[model samples]
Target: MPRVADGSIPGGPRHVALIMDGNGRWAQQRGLPRTMGHREGVRALKRTIQAAPDFGIECLTVFGFSTENWSRPAEEVSDLMGLVRTYVANDLKRLERAGVRLRVLGRRTGLPDDIAAIVERAEQTTAHNDRFLLQVAFNYGGRADIVDAARKHLDRVLAGETGEALTEDILGAGLSTVGAPPVDVIVRTSGEQRLSNFLLWEAAYAELIYQNVLWPDYGPEALADVVTQYRNRDRRFGGVESATARVVG
Candidate 1:
């Protein structure tokens, strides 16, 4: 619950999901290697983590590597994997020092054993840290997550736990971010206007903002601006009429 510099805004979103895109296009536009953009994007991620609390963000879910990203060039994929390794192996301690809890939200069945081990270590190390929750969506797809949740409920039902119909709460308990608050805002960088298969279930009522700024260029100021925009939004969920409408009628 870190306060902004102005300390005027009392509260803001507890959860924010980000679609970090345009690394390859950004590098190509600058006539540099895409790897450089990825590296810079990591820097931007660190900056965002540092700025999260100032914006009143309790949980941050970032789309790190989607399942579809595996179709990219082999070298780029390797570079991306290397970055994951570097983050989990090296930067994890930094997260620990910063009191940020790290959670990887995705399938881990066929992942590299080394990355899996590091992920285990990171999660264990930060399990008790209550300061911040950071969810990295690696090998994650929204549809796949929902399917997994369904399968989990099915298994429970088969075990005779509940013979009745499945409710949203029952299924939500199986989600990776079950304990955290639902996403309040979704921000995509690099001018991308699509969810790109990010958080499907949790974003049912999320306010989305697409920015033209590349992921590598997103900094603390960008985060502040995004939060400012979120603050100005009118979140009515679905209902347009208030309780007083019945009295008026």
Candidate 2:
């Protein structure tokens, strides 16, 4: 692991979101099954969850499986679903030991009953953990999130709840990540430059980082590099840069 002299990320983001990409590509390049790359990605996820707090991040959200991914070949999708089951079965206790809270943010209408039960149990088991919150955006899409929130809000309005405020806070409450903090930095691995429908609302003013390394290969060193790059940026947030802007711990 790369260590900073100060033992923290300078100007580190409070909330970091990762679009973990390139699993299939990584497998293709290595002449292996895509499932193998996904398995490695899971290992990388474990490393990231363990290292995130040390880097000064309070919240971490990963784009684990997108709704669009269901369009892939049936065998691959099944494999991915199996991977999710395996992850929950194997990592629940370890995550609890690390004080990591597991949160899943997505629609679960079509998910298998057993998998949904596993997700619910994992969440319940880690609800009281305070060290870090890890949100997995499984079967998630940014546009879908917005639409769902809007529909929920409309439903409330239709139920004789008149004059209800429709502010950002209200809309945010209706979204999957209802109480989570906004994302401050969004990182996409595999050299991808697009958001690909991840955290559209929360990441409005986030610092974006792109890495050439695939998700399976991303580790603590890569995370440190992203934080270093973030520290070097000028985040004006639509305002004039502060004359005496300084990095935070």
Candidate 3:
């Protein structure tokens, strides 16, 4: 493995998106309230973020709450919202001190005023950090993101920017994840194989890996193992064999 000056696995992917699933199932398996599992999942997220740099991950995007999640029980949704507030309250200072820049992706209009304020505070407070980027996809959906991007692009066109032709770059620029690098690998925990409407556009060519471990049980070891799998794969961005593409069985 290639190592950086700080002994990090420099050969690993630049960005890793995680589908944090199975929290409720985990709690159910233990006969505990599903909300309890979400709390534990938050702790797991903390651990993973702290360990990401060591595995060569510059940006980590995690799916926290999806747009479709609103269909779930009200109590569950409230609990989920509470978890976000608790996480920010307990970890924001430490994350800022660690040089981690935080960005919460997804629709902000529907969020409660307090949550919206908290989100803004988290982003602004850590805006200066550059050591790493953490994007939490809350109330986000892949299809919805595409539509939002499309709507923004349409608005620009309607506003007499007709001279500018529509292109992939034009549409991509409107995405919530526009500034972040394209995802290198997308991992779904709890043995799930589906993207579940998470980072659809950004993950166009990202390698997908599903882990048997649940989200609450995930940690550095699991992340490192996924990076190893990512390293062993042959990634061809539509072209044939190239010098940079690895051939592994």
User: By lDDT, who's the top model here?
Assistant: 3
Q: TM-score ranking from best to worst?
A: 3, 2, 1
**Candidate 1 local Cα displacement, residue 146, angstroms:** 0.2
State the lDDT of candidate 2 residue by residue for 127-229, as single tens digits.
9998889999998999999999988888888897856867887888888987787788899999989999999988888889999999999889988887777
Cα error, candidate 1, residue 153 (Å): 0.9
Task: Give the per-residue Cα lDDT of candidate 2 at 30.
Answer: 98
Worst 10 residues of 3 by lDDT: 240-249
Clashing residue pairs for model 3: none
- Report the alpha-carbon TM-score of model 1 versus the true structure: 0.91
Give every collision pair in model 1.
none
Candidate 1 per-residue C-alpha lDDT over 174-247 given as tens digits, one digit per residue, 9 for 90 to 100: 88778887898999999879898899998898989998899988888988878777766767678885322332
For model 3 the local lDDT of residue 219 reads 97
lDDT of 3: 0.90
Residue-wise lDDT of candidate 3 within 1-249, one digit each (tens)? 668677666457889999999898899999999999999999899999999988878999999899999999999999999998888999999999999999999999899999999999999999999999999998899999989998887887898776677689988998899899889899999997899999999888899999999999999999989999988777778888741345322
Error of 2 at 224 (Å): 0.2
In model 1, what is the error at residue 149, expressed in angstroms? 0.2
